[model samples]
Target chain A: MNLRRKKLWMTVTLAVLAAAVILIPAPALAANPIERFVMVEASQYAFTPATLHANPGDTVTIELHSADVAHGIYVEGYGVSAEAQPGQPVAFTFVVTESGVFRLRCSITCGALHPFMLGRLTVGPNWTLARAAALAGLAVLAAPLAVRRETA
Target chain B: MNRVSLLQIPWLKAALKNRWPQFTISALLMAGFVFAIVAGLVGTPVGSRNFGIIAVWIAWWAILILAVVPVTGRGWCSVCPIPMAGDFLQRRSLLGPNGGRTRGLNLRLPKLFRNIWWQNAAFALMAIFSAAILTNPRVTALALIIMLVAAIGMSAVFERRSFCKSVCPVGGFIGLYSQVAPLELRVADAAACASCASKACYNGSEAGYGCPWGTFPAGLTRNPACGLCLECLRSCPNDNIVLNLRPFAADLEKPAARLDEAFKAFLMLGAALVYAAVFLGPWGNLKVAALAAGTWPWLGYAAAFLLICLALLPGLFWVAVRLAKRMAPAKPHTARRHDFAQAAAALVPLGLAFWAAFSLSFVFANGSYLLNVLSDPLGWGWDLFGTAGAVWSPLYGSWTVAVQVGVLALGAFGAARVAQRAGARGGLHPLPVSGYSLALTVVMMGLLL
Candidate 1:
């Protein structure tokens, strides 16, 4: 194959692989939502604040940081995962519509306890649209403060 | 019977030569990897953990061992330590003392018996044991120890590459599949080889070892016994040795010469077939119990299975060899063993398809539980880590099956092309109908799986 063709094929391959690893469905909601500014600490095998809960139609932007080592946060159902390194936080946003609790697990084998490490989020009956709107305002305002602290 | 010659592909030729060092290093690097796996099995707890990691490991091993190794030919063998261990133990002097003379207690064996059957036997032995312990920590440990012992034992007796050429399942795998690998090492100038005299490549030297597999470098034109060791490359004064970057599956052929290589290919096909039957077949329950029980009766049954899988199949190959001889166009009485060997090459693709079918179910059956297991083990609160919504994800299985089927199809097509090319040289007609049937078989396997 020629150089151009090789590059084109390689790009195509990478794109496909990326799609396989990262494709997920958007959350279903009834307009009003819970907005949560969440921080997740990932390690070699486990992630802290592993279980996350929010009302129906809640939106979450998780600021993920690694405490000890490299870990991949792969959510199989959602098809979203982020690579977490020590002290470096990654951002990922997702909304869950299913009212039941969803299980979460580390995709990477980080340490000895990798097998036992797990957490889950319990979505409750108290979820409402008005409260979610208020939470969204807090989230927009809070991100700037976090960025300012980061710069400082 | 790959009838094609890929020598005309110049870019491939250059790419092969340029990438030699990387492949050489990678070969040796793989030995270290085997060591790490052994170490992990020995030191880590014997408990079963998450299934996802197991799936990944299994998939990685399959891709690397079955698909990758076989296609690349003696590329892996060049650096495989299984042979090196035997060479070291058997050869007293590491640096070929007495000017690389073949003068010592470790005498070279007869040329006729230096085929891949012995190695096939060894590989089969491992497969029997692997039935249960392939996934287990203790079994993997025992398996590694056995390999170490084999290396030590073979080196004590054989002159060079006794374990690698004669034994080692992984070696057999690579040798068989390597016919399909795009990269190959070969002679730069056949004319140079024809004219040259020292024969330093086949015979030893003070500088480096000879072709341990007993391949006379001057005579070799294809990639069967050539270990990609580059010893001959350096030893050759003719400047004839060079690695070829060629179309994959270029060497699948029906030969009139190189009898041992023909047998080795058959042995490889047989191994692939048996591996599928044992690993993927419905009899897995009995296979598992037979090993873990560890009684004499169980051992006997397991041994019987091994015999049927490895030895019986090779025996059938020899029979096929005889049958293939009659099928040859011109000569029936003196049909070459090489022809039989080339036909054996067709077995690779069929076996590959079987493996893909077997592994696909695990993608759906076992994947979700692994994702679920992580939350409790390391106390990660993330719900997919513990997420209830993550349960019953079936795409992982379907995607894996698709990938495997693709690999299988490619392998089948390549094998058929090479077989057809080789068969044509012997004046045999191409088996396009048979090829189509095999292709359909592979497709059906994916759809069914």
Candidate 2:
């Protein structure tokens, strides 16, 4: 192929791959949404159940139990929080409205690594990771093709 | 791409040539630096609430990684406070050159210890104990004091800015990644520099001191050694020096020719991956092990970290380069060391992007502490800015992940382009390096997202 045709082909291929990655719908897996009762144990700097999974429209009731000191769980994207003492467990319910992964951070200063203490809440499929990976692959494929090879 | 000389602007050139602007900024930052030490020494033990941790790590670090280094190479070094006191002691004057005289024993650094190997070691040491220094206020203060004293001692012993040039952990990575930045300092008329009787840029003049980083401006083809101090601009008699705005990563067209720099690329990339896994991932045991300083677990973590950075990553990259050389239909006599170092240049952009993505998540999540710490630097119930009562809140929660993905994608793309260029120059295939970068990006994505 000529240089112009090769360039055209490369551009078209990249655009198509990007669109397929971004616009393609994820397979529906939540036909029957149910309630998920998850008991999360919070220790010095970690969550017992590091990741929680639920389907869209399903209710997730998280019971936060502090294993050591007073700790709290703040769910990102949901903007809801629950606090628990050493023995006392605090529970909060939120509907899984988002279809991506959100962080669960410690709302209280438990220790030195308080800010780093984290967990994840995955509602349905994590299409964000999938799409991002696919886009990254597309970028890698397209980058070298776009560069002009310098002649000696 | 065309280069626009920022020195063409009269007022900007005048400001840069004058000593007051740089001096004033450095002085103010030095005051803040001292205050951070004091706060760290006496303030509340909570790392989040301490000014030293928040200001230095979160606020200043955010600006340095997200803006300063990416937008203007070595812009932070122009006003960094770490070497200010040392410079003052060495020159005996802050505002001007005292007829280009110096104080103390201005001994030359031994040639064997001249490269960035010391910097690599220093940075590795800091990275090993980063969990402690970044968390404990006392540890942070002591670390700062050690760096300050070391800089002062090095200045007293060796010649111009040797500490920054050869020992500063932060400066090492800054210099490495600064090659990707669009801004650069160079001589506009090379013949003018060649014809000049007095090389005042390296040697001091009445107008300004010599290059503090000990680099000759006329020979500069890359950004690593130049600190962007603009001393050469003032000292040059024929006005040969020009600060130009050029294409990003313009320096990467030519691969690095040193093994130390290649190792630096690997070290930084590996550090980023380790930090992502330890600090941001959902692995609690890893965090505990990293935080438990002096314990066996911490030792294990440190050893593993060192192995990954110094051995595993570089070993894997070397294998990839060797494989590429064997596969390529080029001269079989190409030097193995040359091929490896050249191909390793491809990791520079990817390493920078990894740091940016990691800093984005860390700073965005913890940036709110800046307000609280600013108001109450000592955490002594003082609300100087009325934000002491502000609550902890992560900013742009889910959007941060999206931005991280975008940044990583861009970084991967840049790395691929650089790999192709390096391959073209080194008579090797670009696929292995590109594949390595892609695999790391996927792992980074997995750790982060």
Candidate 3:
């Protein structure tokens, strides 16, 4: 390959790798779909149904309730939040257009394990996992190539 | 090795020469420290609202990770209140020179506990309970008070700053990561140090006391042990002591890596990974197991934590080293153990970066509480600053992932470069070592990002 072509290819490859690294997270998107309600219970350092699944364009209404003290749900990447006092259900709805794994954490100062209170939400066809794997592969392959290039 | 000596600057020299500035900063920190302990004991149980938790875990941690350790090596140690209390009690005066007389027993630190092994163990013990400690105001206060008492007790029974040098859990990692800090303290002229008959930097002088952490400034090549107390700067009659502003990771080029130090790097990287998984990862059962202390699940969790930190990560790293050895063009006289040690040292920069990246999520996401808790220290409906009712808002939100990736990449590249250097020093090929580091970097990126 010519020097210019080689440089172009290298730039393209690096751009793709960068994209793969940053592809795991996304904000909520506008989509019309049947709304599905998810009833989630937050206890001491845990959330019921720790893993929730949804289709790409599905609207998710999460009714968050604290089994113990006051708690709040802060969904990662969606910018959706709700506060739930004990026995009081707080409903938050958002359209899930991001096809990736996101975390829902207790936002309130709940207890000693407040920081650890977490749950996972997986949108269908999780591209984040595939992109992460691709990133890893790119690292493994590119490391040797860079080393050789330096030595050369 | 090129350095810009701070003492060369007239204003900086004048400022450092005076004890009042250092004393004032130390006193302020001491007051804050006392307030944290009091707030933890008597304040609200809520971690976010409590001043102790918000200030110590959120605000102080943010500064420590994002500013202090990266920019200044052991700068926090210079003004640390923990050792201030011990030093004051031992010297019998805050500003006066020890005059070759320490009030404490002044017994030597145990020969077996001389190296950083005790520190590593203490850090591991703290890591095990870190989840609880980070969120509980009472627990956090108790831990600080215990350390304070321990520091005082150690000063009374043992020698100077033994708690900091040999026992403090937080100090261990601070010391480890301080190697990467840009600022360093050293004697400017080696010949001057050699010619001087009175090594007042190590011993005491009329101007200042001896090195509190037992470090002789002349032989200082690294920032790991030297608690930058600035006593050496004051005590040196030859004026040999120089604080230099330099590049980061200047001390990572060890001729021979100590096993304890290498293991410290491993522990730091491993613990960062584990903490990321438990605190940030989408796993509820793991968090539950981590929280339930003394239970069967908790024991299992503890075992797994220890295994990952002590065995699995080190074992994987050893395999990487072995593979590097096999792939590299072998040098006839080189010892495998020595090469292994060198390879581990190369990971120090990456380890520090891993910590920084992990800490970003911690400090940024939860850091907003600093405002709320500052205004209402005890969460007792007292809005001193009118910002007590401030809403909890995480800054930069999802952009943190990108920042973390960038930081990790920087660290990974640094580690690769260091590995290449080590490879050249040992007459080996750099490819495999760099490859191993890249693999580890990808793993960290996957975990955090």
Measured by TM-score, the strongest candidate is 2
| Docking quality level of the chain pair in candidate 2 | medium
Candidate 2 regions with alpha-carbon error over 4 angstroms: A149-152
| Rank by DockQ (best first) | 2, 3, 1
Model 3 regions more than 4 Å off = A1-36, A54-57, A85-88, A97-101, A122-152, B332-335, B427-429
lDDT of 1 by residue, B56-77 (tens): 2443454555555645656556
Every model: iRMSD: 21.7, 1.0, 3.3
Q: In candidate 2, which residue pairs get closer than 3 Å at backbone N, Cα or C atoms, i.e. clash?
A: none
- The candidate that wins on lDDT is 2
Q: Report the Cα lDDT for candidate 3.
A: 0.79
RMSD of each candidate relative to the true structure: 16.4, 1.4, 3.8
Residue B322 CA error for candidate 1 (Å)?
Answer: 10
lDDT per residue for candidate 3 within B1-449, as digits (tens), equals: 56888889989888887899999998999899999999999999988889999889888888887789888868888888888878888899989796757987889999987888888998888788877788888989999999899889999988888989988887887887888888899898888988888888888889889899998888888898799888888889988899998866777655356778777878888888888888877677888788777889888888888898889877877787777777777664677777777788667778877888888876777777888987999989999988998987777355776566666766776677667767766765666666666777777766665
For candidate 3, the TM-score is 0.89
Candidate 2 chain B — worst ten consecutive residues by lDDT sum?
B326-335
Better of 2 and 3 by lDDT: 2
TM-score of chain A of 1: 0.54
* Model 2 lDDT tens row, A1-152: 98878878888989998998888888887478899899999998999899998888899999999999999999988889988999999999989877888889999989999999999898887888888888888998887666863331
Which DockQ values do the candidates obtain, in the order shown? 0.02, 0.79, 0.33
Candidate 3 local lDDT, A24-135, one digit each (tens): 4654545545678999998877788887888788889999988989988888888789989997898988998767677777888777777667787888655554555455
Candidate 2, residues B337-359: lDDT per residue as tens digits? 88888888889999999999999
At residue B217, give the lDDT of candidate 1. 66
